[model samples]
Target: MTNVLQVIPARQGRAVRLQAGQAIRIVNTHGTQVVDTWCFNAADMGEFMSMEHLHATLGSIFPVRGEPLFTNRRRPILILEEDTSPGRHDTVIAACDVHRYALLGCRDYHDNCTDNLHAALRQIGLRSDECPSPLNLWMNIPVAPDGRITWGEPLSKPGDAVVLRAVMDCVVAMSACPQDMIPINGADCRPVEAHYEVLT
Candidate 1:
């Protein structure tokens, strides 16, 4: 059976602390949901996180079966034991904002991952709230060798999920996509749930 915990950031909620090396599962309870995620060195927040560096060092764009994801500091954070589907997700696209909203022109909806990062920063006491670009978990962002990318149909189904085993004491910041400007959230700002378990 799957374990689940719900989190509602209330339009301005942020900052979640994780015990070092604990396994965490952030679930997209709804389909077409986009999530902005990041992890920091618990002891030294300045070290921050780098998704590109992680991918390069690991030599694979996507997480392998039964592999644990780690921070830039070489610390274990999330281990992907299972992936429901190989949804073309993005690790390069940063969150959007109201100013961006204006730049992109008026849209029907407007909730962004950047806002969630802001909320999380405000909760964590500012210093560690650097808007480090996140890895979009379920949303597909396909990148081509020609340096182009596009948001494609979700590779995950309604009940599809990713399982991660956290390897270090860490702080996780997430935005349960409020994206209406892009194809990622399907023009709907949906909420997601997170769950944790103590593995023996």
Candidate 2:
């Protein structure tokens, strides 16, 4: 079968399985979306991609293309093989959740990346006991010299893409972040859809 472009609907999420040596190209289709991305070892759900470990391994908060995304065990789970944007993906922030929205003055239940991640996993008949800190694809958070960090709009343009190759059998989950309370998705704070394709 052809490798078709799959849509991660606006304010929703998706998950896919990949074998070692396979890759997934995630696209910022509209340029205004922040996709919260996570990876889990297919053989062991407890071994998932970890942002804290990633920061320690990369020695930076921003992941560079061609570097491996490390798991909590300090093992490489996926390699960021190719990136078409300016490479400003954030690793410092936690995935947004309902509590975050509540803190933002949202009185009603709000769609969030944390919920999206779990829902996506369930769609594929899998479940995770915890939500790991995701690689905030295209989500820009600028750090200051004094150690303050501020949310910034993404510098990536429409059609920008990143290809992540699996180092071991794994499952990748992505949530098209629904962060309308803030402008992290864009200056307008409008979240939108993204696309991805699995490569053999």
Candidate 3:
């Protein structure tokens, strides 16, 4: 059976449930949109994917295809099975929030990934007070040898996709990052929609 494609609308979010051994194929339909992704235990929301633990587990900030995405409990939550992009996902930047926009001189309300995550969860009748750092798919942040980091446009092209297989039953949430203030999404600094499919 074919898995149906679902839209993660630009400047919005979506959430889906997955069983153990299942996978999600996320597509960068427009090539430039950055997807902020998060995974949580289906039975316990507190036990979710942890970037800090994942860094210590992999000994690297960049997670490659075939590596397991670990949880705060230091257990495998999901495995990045395939990636067609340049593998430049960002692991350090916090999801964009209202405060971030304020710092950017936005005096008005802006669509943000942090709010998107929580809203997505609530759509599925779930709730998480804590916003764990997300796996910023396609976000390019280059770290210099001098310990400075520079935000760069994504190197991924249109139709680039990634398959993330769940190691355990989980709920995956995704936000098409609404960061038009920077060029991390693309050279045009415009956010766009992406798509995903849950696979067995």
Candidate 4:
């Protein structure tokens, strides 16, 4: 099957629909960018992908290839098909929002994952405040021996990617993380292009 590729600009958002049996590949084009991702059942938004359910089902904080991603309704939505980078994706961190920037001492408006998610969802005529926490791809948040979580730089190199097959028809939303205040995307907060491919 031919693949359809979409490039998500730095600090921007995108929305796409995937049918069951189709796969989406997210590429870390520049290596240091983090992609905040979320998925919803195409038939019902209430049964969206749940990070809590995934944690409970997998018993792990990070994603592993070949594992199924469960929704809030306990149904499989997508399966991790492949991972080319070090498997350090995070599922525990909440998407960045306007309030986070405020807490970080930034009184000005900043591009954030929450707003991006809303904008992406809006493209499909779905509007709600029930934005689910996302699976943070290529993001490095290491847990210390003392249970301390520290934000670190991503481990993926340029062109690294992860592929996931949709178990059910779903709408996927993604945001190139725009956090410049931390080392999550290396020294600077500059965003980079993220390449996405949908393969039938």
Structure candidate 3, residue pairs in collision: none
| Window of ten residues with lowest summed lDDT in model 3 | 1-10
lDDT of 3: 0.96
Q: Candidate order by TM-score, highest to lowest?
A: 3, 2, 4, 1
Those runs of model 2 whose alpha carbons end farther than 4 Å from true positions after fitting are none
In order of listing, the candidates' clash counts read 13, 0, 0, 1
> Can you write out model 2's per-residue Cα lDDT over 43-147, one digit (the tens) per residue?
999999999998888898888888999999999999999999999999888999999999999999999999999999999999999999999999989999999
Q: lDDT of each prediction vs. the true structure?
A: 0.63, 0.95, 0.96, 0.90
For residues 117-182, write the lDDT of model 4, one tens digit per residue.
989889878765687989999999999989899998998999999998999999989999888898
Error of 2 at 56 (Å): 1.3
lDDT for 83 in candidate 2 is: 98
Q: What is the lDDT of residue 187 in candidate 2?
A: 92
Model 1 per-residue lDDT tens digits across residues 1-200 = 33345464433334566665455565555556666777776778866557767687667766666765666666556666666756455667776666677787865556666776876767777545456767677778788899788866566666566655556666767776665556666544434443333332
Q: Look at candidate 1 and tell me the lDDT of residue 46.
A: 69
Query: lDDT value for candidate 4?
Result: 0.90
Winner on lDDT between 1 and 3 is 3
Residue ranges of candidate 4 with Cα displaced over 4 Å: none
TM-score of each: 0.79, 0.98, 0.99, 0.97
